[model samples]
Target chain A: MEFKNVTVVKKANIYFDGKVVSYTVKFEDGTTKTLGCMQVGDYTFNTGAAEVMEFLSGELSVELPNQKEPLIIHSQATFEVPANSSFTLHVKSIADYCCSYAK
Target chain B: MEFKNVTVVKKANIYFDGKVVSYTVKFEDGTTKTLGCMQVGDYTFNTGAAEVMEFLSGELSVELPNQKEPLIIHSQATFEVPANSSFTLHVKSIADYCCSYAK
Candidate 1:
């Protein structure tokens, strides 16, 4: 589902030479999410909590450490990353996404 | 300066058929700013307060009601809008911007 009734936190965290940028949003049920954009590049990210990422625009090729083949996610698609794991995202274009974190 | 110490709001407010998207950022001094992206289009916006808009990427042609010619702003450039006034932005590409509001 799209975010229609969430409170956006008022801070921005930029990473990797300004290639990836995102903001935090708080849900009514105390869960938090991140919405941001990524430029064309390959990025490695380590997650402490499990995350479900929803793509809003562009395309992404994701490589999980445990998977043999890379997963291709297009616009309006969703992917998940396990907790305490690292994943790599291969961005072909400027991608916009929303990430929901599990509590 | 780019956003580093700001807090991102957890909600998103979409406008104009999702042509423009942005999230709010709160500052340490209690000031608020907005960071977002705009697709290629012509958009007219009315503001209740004064705003300084900084272009992060792409190009923008802005026309204020009092100005005779449109102002061309490039990436990393900034433009200001007066309170209670309206302005039009002619977007050539997907433009990223950061807007700080005067309170």
Candidate 2:
């Protein structure tokens, strides 16, 4: 689906030395989301706001805070990360995802 | 700058085995642009519509169609490619760019 009537940042948000990258998308209602891609690698992210990570394609296993085992995600899945927390992701392939930040 | 009141595609345009990736942004004027990132590598792109590649950051050397020598680009630069033509870029570092296609 397409995000309509929003603002898109021109520059990308690069992380893990370019292993993970995203672009900021701002909605009219003052909400924000990031469309990102993750290459095959392991990554850890610290969140300020609570986030919902929705996967569009590819494969990954995520270790969320207080979770016993990593949750495996394939194409079309969603996971939530709490605010002021951290999560680890082991990307099995090239994963494309959208992360919505809670205000 | 940000593209306001636009529509952004959720998925990314992955190229060259994730060496090059972009998100498509559509404007109200029926124009479209791709906000993209390029890792340190050489990439060749064939264009259907004419394109103007505006670099926001990083270093690269571009070989456009009909050009004898490649043009070196630093942090901020712009280059044009003809429609139905191709160009090559040798990225020295991770590069962030906005690619506008001619309507």
Candidate 3:
């Protein structure tokens, strides 16, 4: 199966100064998922299994707990829904739930 | 091709209580990434392409800029290296680099 990005996640590598930066990835969506932090050195992230469009920007914002930070990854999200599987993703946002996903 | 998850990114959801929380993901790795602000209601994130077995924990930690928190996502990262493509993901970490990746 091929992939079409549902959204894009762009990550930037800031200079030692912390204020300056370099950008990688392009964009991402709600279902898209990633691991680790998105900073200098060797950052990491990945795509979720759902498509998010109906949701607003604020809705897509994933706020970590306490003092954890959110990763800003670049590049669109793409995943080939597995073949003959029962698991599927549900599409919605933190603000307003708007879609249903199933296989 | 199938995925093997170079790393895993796990996220959690907090109750209205705030201080308390609920864990969803099992584990993550260095290449994994996330988006938005992982909190109540809905959240989003993605996976970074890279294997970090060669790195350490502190290396897997993802720190965002300003006050942006990082999403604690669960699950593994799996991407099928296209059958024939020049662009391939390099595996590494933000700490103690130890590997080279390419197709």
Better of 1 and 2 by DockQ: 2
lDDT tens per residue, model 1, A4-103: 4556543355677556767777766888888987777899999999999888776789998689999898766888899999999999877778898998
Q: Model 2, which residues run further than 4 Å from truth? A: none
Error of 2 at A62 (Å): 0.6
Interface RMSD (one decimal) of model 2: 0.9
| Model 3 deviation from the true structure expressed as Cα RMSD, one decimal place | 18.5
Q: TM-score of every model?
A: 0.59, 0.97, 0.16
C-alpha DockQ of every model: 0.12, 0.86, 0.03
Q: After superposition, how far is residue A92 of candidate 3 from its true place, in Å?
A: 30
Q: Is candidate 1 or candidate 3 better by TM-score?
A: 1
Candidate 2 collision pairs: none
Report the alpha-carbon TM-score of model 3 versus the true structure.
0.16
lDDT measured at residue B79 in model 3 versus the true structure, 0 to 100: 27
Instruction: Give the per-residue lDDT digits (tens) of candidate 1, residues B26-82.
Output: 767878888877777899999998999888776779998689999997766788899
lDDT by residue (A1-103, candidate 2, tens digit) is: 8999999988899998888899999998899999999889999999999999999988889999989999998778998999999999999888899999997
CAPRI grade of model 2: high
Sort the predicted structures by lDDT, highest score first: 2, 1, 3
Total clashes for model 1:
17
